[model samples]
Target: MSPTGERVAMATDELQATLPPAVTVYERSVYSDGDSTFALVNDADGKRRLYVAGPAIADFDGGTVQGDGQVFPLTYGNAMALAEVFPWLEPTTAGRQSAFGFGDRIGLATPGHVRAVRDSDLVPVFAQQSIREMDRTGRSPEDVLATAIFGVFQEGYEGGFVADADHLMAREDVERTAGVGFTMFTCDPSEHVVADADSMSEEKVEAAFAQIEDSEAILDRYAGETFEAKTDGFTWSDSFSEIELKRAAVKYYEAIEFAEELYGWVAQAVDGDFDFEVSVDETETPTTHLEHALIASELDRRGVEVTSLAPRFVGSLEKGIDYIGDLNEFEADLKGHVAIAETYGPYRLSLHSGSDKFSIYPFFEEYASDYQHVKTAGTSYLEAIRVVAENDPDLYREIHAFALERFDEDKATYHVNTDLSNVPDIDDLTDDEFPKILDQDDGRQLLHITYGSVLSATDENGEFRFKDDLLGTLREYEDDHYAFLEEHLGHHVDLLTGEIED
Candidate 1:
């Protein structure tokens, strides 16, 4: 053993001898909670647990604790704050690469996510959820982190993971997510991206540019500025002309300003390394080459250190579906984006609506060296519904019917195209046949957007309709759910890693 290991082992031996039989000294350290020198240890149940050894369990109140397991005052809600007990859990400056945010919107898929991530050489973001999703499902950020950590604990996954506060907009949101110990922040500027920017007239563009407070400074820095490839990782075109420069600045200045404000807030409020990203993918128009340059340059000028950026591309990246645009056109746009990354950011090109776009995986595999990240949330939800359909077809039928009704209401906040006429009449299908809904396009989109309604919907009595049945059914078949994700998301990771044969 190393010197530190030897020292820790000796201390653990000494402490384990004094501890009771119900609890064991699983870890050894000199860390103290309040009045007592305590260490995180395992219970007799084989759980990686830490409890107050002596009388301190009842009195301690630092970080939040799960009140059900009242053996000791756990700091990290259920366990002691891992960041305090373990050095690896603490946030640190990222290396050249960062993990893709595996957003577990349903809160039960992390065990499966960890399973997929363990086999690959990729960093896994285990705790990733957005503010809107939290509101829709009535989940707090603390609950999201707790569920993820519990899954990690269940699998005994010691490999480090990142907790991402995805698509954060306001200072209050940052404060709440940081309080729950999120290590990464993706600030979205979708609200600021003006509509139809790619088709804006030159007169309108010039007028918008002329009105910015720092218009002269931003213009002078890039209007006639030139750049060529400096190194290998990120490449620039032969040149960036004045026209391109003006176009980018005109299209993205307002969004840049909003991003800067939010990014600055997160950078200041966060206790450690503020892993920051800029997301502009929710707009109406596709982001162009010059627009990417403009956004990066503006952020850099404001001293915002961006770790990643998501630009809206030409295609429609819908939830729970494959890529919809022309593949060749997408390839051309992707080439320019990679070049922009080479010139502007050695940062990850974040993909926002990246759930089931299978056609694009090969391209990602080919450009794996470009330092990219793809985020997924809805596909996992669909996977959970798949579990319900397989295990309890009655509940599946009820939820599907409810989802069809809730589609219009819930889809207001999302961007997807689904014609109800295209959806099959669920009444015509037998219980055994209900599972086929998942294989169809309209059914996938309908169920995808209406997840919030189906999960949170209630009958006239105000009690949960399908929520209880869904969670219970999932609990009964939890192993099956994990297996499905292993085969499903594992395929996605494999495809991106070039592990899957063409």
Candidate 2:
């Protein structure tokens, strides 16, 4: 046998001899970097640890194992070390494909994401979070990436995965997540998107437009010029008149400039190529075709290659619920956006706040095809709560009651219309009926947007009030947790990968 095989054999023998009797090795996880062998093992109590053997064991991070070889606890440093040997642990670009990003606010949802994507056509972005989520949950970029690495390893998923620095609004956000090896930089330029431009008076629009550098050159390029675009089954044309050009420029010029600068920062921070997703989906006004064309063309002119762009589609795509709007209008609007994408760079059109927008997935598959990316952040946390609701009803009840009190304050940042009265009172629901609340709009949004408070809330003595119980219960009932995630996230993957109707 070859020397590498010999090393793997020797490591396997050592792992079998040294590991505690109670620890069951994840058989498929055994891998070798030609010098050392690594595997994931689950203890009798269900805790996971890494088993490494051979001379290279000293180079990897983690504590020593019992009988032979070294065992590393799943940690940020160890995850980094392991990635050096198995490069799949590191994030990579998903390119222009039908991809889905599963955001794990609490960092334990990747295993289920892996299972859901294993047999699907879409690429899986396992480590995805925003700066707001990090601040609220007190989780760093490293924590997000590290937890995903460990979960990916535990499940023996080696098909490859992408990591997204989702909703990055500033240079600092890009730098922080880039330092931790995130490969997808989703630049959120909504702050610079002038939403009032839609209703601004001609004088106001002109003022804002004049403030932009090289306004005349921009106007000369776009004003009175017709641009044609097409997608699979749709063709469209858009032109901006003098006043319309000024409005479009005022609405998105700053945002385009911000993305250009942020793109440079991303290029500087990331050592190699990274997926760049420009997001203006958080704005109040919908992004018209003319606006999208301007943003895409300007970014292209600036030499910024966007892997995907998330426009603020017409209608309401609120958090944690099915879409609420006229589907026909949304489809028409989506066709225009897809046409714009095809005309420019043929990039993916991402859907932000797309946790449970079930009614619209078919439209995306039909219009965007492979040029699409759906991001779902907070839904996994909701599924985790579902596990808690199913297993620990008392804990779920306590969390529900607290969520009610915190909903008004926490709902400030999220774009949700959850009327408190719509949610059934905790006392009115029996223990067996507790899990049913997750299916309701108000109850789901109430629990969905209040995750940060639920995870970080403390008692009067300054100790944690719900964090420990919430996590501990989830950990104890991990199988159920993965099951729920698999069911919910799997449904998403299935819907997005269905056959496109003719």
Computed on alpha carbons, the lDDT of every model, listed in order, comes to 0.72, 0.85
* Predictions: Cα RMSD each: 5.5, 2.8
Clashes of 1: 2
TM-score per model over all chains: 0.84, 0.94
Which candidate achieves the best lDDT against the true structure?
2
lDDT of 2 by residue, 1-502 (tens): 2222322443445566667787767665677766667787776566677877787788766566645666778888889987877776777888887799999988778888888788888889999999888888989999999999988877767667899998888888899999989999999888888888999999998888898888999977887888889866788986888999899888888889899999999999989989999999888878889888888988999999999999999999999999999999999999899999988998999999888888899888878867999999888999999989999998898898899889889888878778878888778878989988999998899999899999889999998889888888887887898888998888887777773321
Once superposed on the true structure, which residue ranges of model 2 sit more than 4 Å away at CA? 1-18, 32-35, 44-46, 499-502
lDDT of 1: 0.72
Candidate 1: pairs in clash: 234-342, 235-342
What TM-score does structure 1 among the candidates reach?
A: 0.84
Q: Find the candidate with the highest TM-score and give its number.
A: 2
